[model samples]
Target: MTPGALAEGRPEARGPRFRVVVETGPDARQEIPLEGTLLVGTQVEGGLRLSDPTVSRVHLELQARPEGVRVRDVGSRNGTWSLGVRIHEVTLAGEARFTLGKTTLLVMPEPTEEAAEPAPRTTFGRALGQSAAMQKLFGVLERTARSSFSVLLLGETGTGKELLAEAIHRASPRSNQPFVIVDCGAVVPSLIESELFGHAKGAFTGAHADRRGHLVQADGGTVFLDEVGELPLELQPKLLRVLESGTVRRVGDNAAKDVDVRVVAATHRDLKAEVAAGRFRADLYYRLAVVPVRVPALRERAEDIPLLARHLFQQAGQPDFPLTEELVQRLMGYDWPGNVRELRNFVHRVLAAGDAELPDTRPVSAVTAAEDLSGLTFKEAKERMVEAFTREYLTALLARCGNNISEVARTAGLARSHVHGLLNRYGLKAGD
Candidate 1:
């Protein structure tokens, strides 16, 4: 059995902590203590009989193994028709369920408490990769959940921008409220203003009745303005005003109404260049980018491809199916310029194409495109990579010093300030 939902411990990385789920059997309810290893077995009217009675120093030793762990039959003259089974017996690593007689085991591993993080919804259409990048993305989602600031997501199309935006909304305090989504570029140029800011009755042709705008509908929650860079030049000021004043004015109405909503904007275009070209407003950019986050493209975070592919498949809502390691490897090696959204679509497409059969692997070809991206000029892939020496030195020092930067620096004949600067430069903090 694995473990259950848990808080992350240790500085696994500069990210969320994780735990695992393990199952003993059914009728074996137990909780993982905050400390110590978890054990589950039946209480024999007393405590465990062992040479070491170390329960005092232990955190928890909960065991309620099913009859499957020790199958036995009861005496009955009429005979009994009962089902007893023991389906799995693996050490704790991931979550799974096992059968044991009348009872079953449900093992769980909290690999990050990661399910809660929200992915930014993007206009991207392709996703590729399987590696640390996916983990990092989840970590980003976890971190974003702790704040309510306006988040500006930057990523190319097919990058799952909108997905992340919704994740943030769901993880936010306003999850229960309206999560209004609007495509700034999707609106026809002539109708963009009317669509975002509600139009009053008779405001314009086809304005038959008073209608609520996307901003107002998201009054108590979040407004995801995808492709925000496409917002018309004329509409920029009004949008900024609403962001600044928390008010949305209808087209035909002279008065403005107050609204309580968080604005999360996303666009692949470079806002800075857009501002310079007079295509985007600088003030609005500042207001919306209180927390600017760049969604790493598929190729950039390829390490997370396997996990993402698995998750995207699961997200398909299909029960009782798992992906194979071979398929996962093919996916992990791909270059996903499209990012997570692409991966989701690929999973959906694969499931639909082969009904989840392992043979049908068009998804593999889609990811092989990563090689294409990789072949591009070095300038094309502006990724930050640690030098081999720096990585080895840092790893060795931290391990030897028990992750103490001061101690490592002292032993290595380096100034603490320089070491701290290096750690900061490399995105390494204490514990990692």
Candidate 2:
């Protein structure tokens, strides 16, 4: 049977709502809202049933508990694994990852509405946003910066996670102290250990003299671990130890010295899935994700696009560039898969082209749409036309309803699931 949504008689409400993300294997990229007790296997009657032969007929079970979700393996041919270790049962209070057969599943508590808070200022530190999502995030950041907890910034590429991390540091009490950034993905793996924990003289061929690592350099301050998911698996333990003990031991030296450092890690990867797949250490994941915050994708807050575009133009020294209503509409209609970075590149391209022949920013006219369909097979042309029409219709519908998915679904006479599928396919995100 094809994978689809499962409906179960509601049990007494227990714990917050949760969703399961199928990261790999069969049904990969599918998200299912989980409620009550969920029975997942290859041959289950109602709950999630996979088509993969590797998945046992009765592989695993998940029951929602008042505290959290309790997951158990029910004696399948292949056992269930969490944190790279086989387990009979485990209770996850927040976010957790586990694997059954060849599939990886990540269970996370669905976002809940919080109490009303103060209105968000249009600008927070270096970041800019006026959307409700941004305002809510600003409130969260305000609270996060007041403390010394290790923060994990999760988001898609080009969503300005690094900027948000720096903003948190600047707003925190550690503003006067050093704020060092360690590009975990850019660092040489062989030298990563020494680079993060410092190295003693003669520790390696390149160690001519003692050097302070990122942790030491940012003593009494904050260290932003950019692209932290790329950190080598072998080095995770050492980093965990530092976070736990507040001390670092230099390479080639036995002595350990104390350092006061706050950690703010940012990553575009699903670290939980990485842990469940054995590519990342579980202990370290817990240590870094003490307070996880997801940075909103650009499409999730399209109203900010015009504001961001003007900011970019001013930054590029092209403040005179005309940002007409048509241009704004065209910009807002795009999916912007690359987020802010893509928008910035687009502004630069327009600047480079010069105003003598400014690029067209108006909506696609019927004549232009027909021209775009030229030189294609009938089937291909039909598909292209359908895609374009669907995109335009959805874009206008979203604007009319203020980015409310439920309203859009009702207005279009489509199921919520169908609407959600369309949104994801078109790279659109409903407002929070």
Candidate 3:
């Protein structure tokens, strides 16, 4: 029988007895027997250590009391939260819950043995990988899902950022509420403001009726801002204001409407670099990145390639299609510039043509598409080959280093500026 069940069946004990349940990270479902002055933080000496980066060295202290348990925030940078509201200190009892950084804590009386089993594992999605990097990412996702703080997902394109965001919503308390998706990149710059914040009727030439924006549409749930870095510079502050005050004013409207929404923003760009370059606002970055979770790029966890490829193949309606070892090797060998999406497309192409062998790595046909090299000089042909080789080499190098230019330079023994120049010259952007 579970510990909770065991505790439930036992006679009521008179002393202070409770368990602090960690609901996320590597310690999910871990129970700490509450005692006098239990310290929780990222520090090793902490009574309960949480390795999440968002957690401060010393976050909160829980002291056993006659009435219940008293939780005091130890001046944590992000602050302690309960039911989406920040609190300096509060007394908790009877299944009280709170959040510390990216971790969630549940304060409850000791469970009976029948009820003492660990929390059930949450199944996020098929795209949710089983690799170590992905497992860590999911841990952050699970923790962040329990809070209302803004989240920023950073990764290369096709790393399943949107799917991850959806998983978070599904795993959250707001799951039953509306989940609104706003593709900032897809919206026109002219209409983005109105689309996100809504507008009063007649605000613009084409305005026909008063409309609620995506933010309002997601009032009680989550607003997923996909490709959020692509949002226009002029509109960022407005977004930031909403994040700060929980109030959004429609374009050309004087009155502001309050919205209770959890914001989850994602981008392929290195937002820190964008902020450094003055393209992205520093204030906005901090507000969105309260819990920044970096989705792992495909090549980082190559061991999962077979599983992902097989899943994609099955998704393509060819579950029985043979994934030969040679084909699997080729899939794992290439640096997926476009990540999982690229791999899925490759699978589609293979299925479409019913090709039994792996496609050639080189575009030999493209080189010969001109019908002859007679019109081209040997020097030109040599230059084309050299360019292709250089571009391919750099692409692989960038993938290996998680798109960090400094790491790539250090490993290749090249100057930072030189690396940037090469990337620019070859039209190879980082985080592709």
Candidate 4:
């Protein structure tokens, strides 16, 4: 969904009384009368007690006036903002929006006698970055939204592939239709087919009644197949048939049922190598990859780390904790082996510890004691250090990519043969 589409709540009226709605947390909504001045802060007495630490005890004061509502910042650490610009005070002639720390406030002019219903909230809205990479991704999404061709999103885990899929759906003509998700990795192979193509009553031992699978259920809509690379080899042909014929044949049923579902698949694995390895079908790969889009890894966009960290910090309810330059530098220097997900977890750990000091990002060999290196020749020690770093790096890389050799190779920018050699040389299994 577009960022603007996330605006929530609306003005409410009770009988002859008018009130302005304030939405704080994800689903918390409150209505306050526009008859008197209201204080918003962390204090218990404030009309709106925002629990965020970035908010001062008396963060903002809003006074209702004949002309409009007057808003003044009451010395908040993070200050206040109107439409994205920082301001100490501003008068709203009518409706306006403002931000205090992590919270957003919408001031509605006194509601009329007839109250309009609030707009529906979108399933996806958070636009986390303004980096060039993100801008390019947005452009691709906008273009893909207008087409019915299948999409293949290539990215590391935690790169927000699912979120992008939702954005594409919300921007498409079928925005009002259902968007179904199928996690191929999580589904058991035995049940994968039945789950994607439903069965008739008594089709199998446990077939209790007739049911429509995700594809049929999502007819006229979109279906996101997450971790599509994990789909079983045996099932790949069936999926390809469905995509080709736009029909599905339920197990134990002869009749083929028509479906009109848009398919969007995502994976961290490199399907080209998978096909070469005889693990995935080349035809299915080509079908799903009509439009391939890559979500850039976090390390490739280090410039966006500060913005992402602050955004995540606010979401974690720790806006008061300063995101120091040292911490940001440390974060940027790290490879972010787990990408955005690891950074988020690191932020949570910092907030939980109530400290801004960041952990060391140095390689394990660099932290080894000098005494432990005694007696070894300089060349021998250097070789050992290189091996140590390589082993550690590959281990984390493999783990983050779900131990898929092709994915690890793609992420590491190494040849499939070279990666296989390294795995053998280091005596490291995919799962290791």
Q: Please list the Cα RMSD from the true structure of every candidate, rounded to 1 decimal place.
A: 23.5, 13.7, 12.7, 22.9
Model 1 accuracy (lDDT, Cα): 0.56
Scored by lDDT, the top model is: 2
User: Candidate 2 regions off by >4 Å?
Assistant: 1-118, 355-432
lDDT of 2: 0.77
Model 3 CA lDDT for position 218: 99
Query: Model 2 clash pairs?
Result: none
lDDT of candidate 4 over 300-356, digit per residue (tens): 888878888888988998777676678778777877767777677667667677544
Q: What are the runs in model 1 whose C-alpha is more than 4 Å off? A: 1-144, 316-325, 354-432
Off by over 4 Å in 4: 1-125, 355-432
Across 336-413, the per-residue lDDT of candidate 3 in tens digits comes to: 765777677667768887644432344544544545656679998767667766776787666555576765675466
Please give each candidate's TM-score. Answer: 0.50, 0.59, 0.60, 0.58
Residues 339-379, model 2: lDDT tens digits = 78767767776788643222233354552465656788999
TM-score of the candidate numbered 1? 0.50
Ranking by lDDT: 2, 3, 4, 1
Model 4 global lDDT (CA atoms, 0 to 1):
0.73
Error of 4 at 333 (Å): 2.1
In angstroms, how far off is 424's CA in candidate 3? 21
Least lDDT summed over 10 consecutive residues: which range in candidate 2? Answer: 1-10
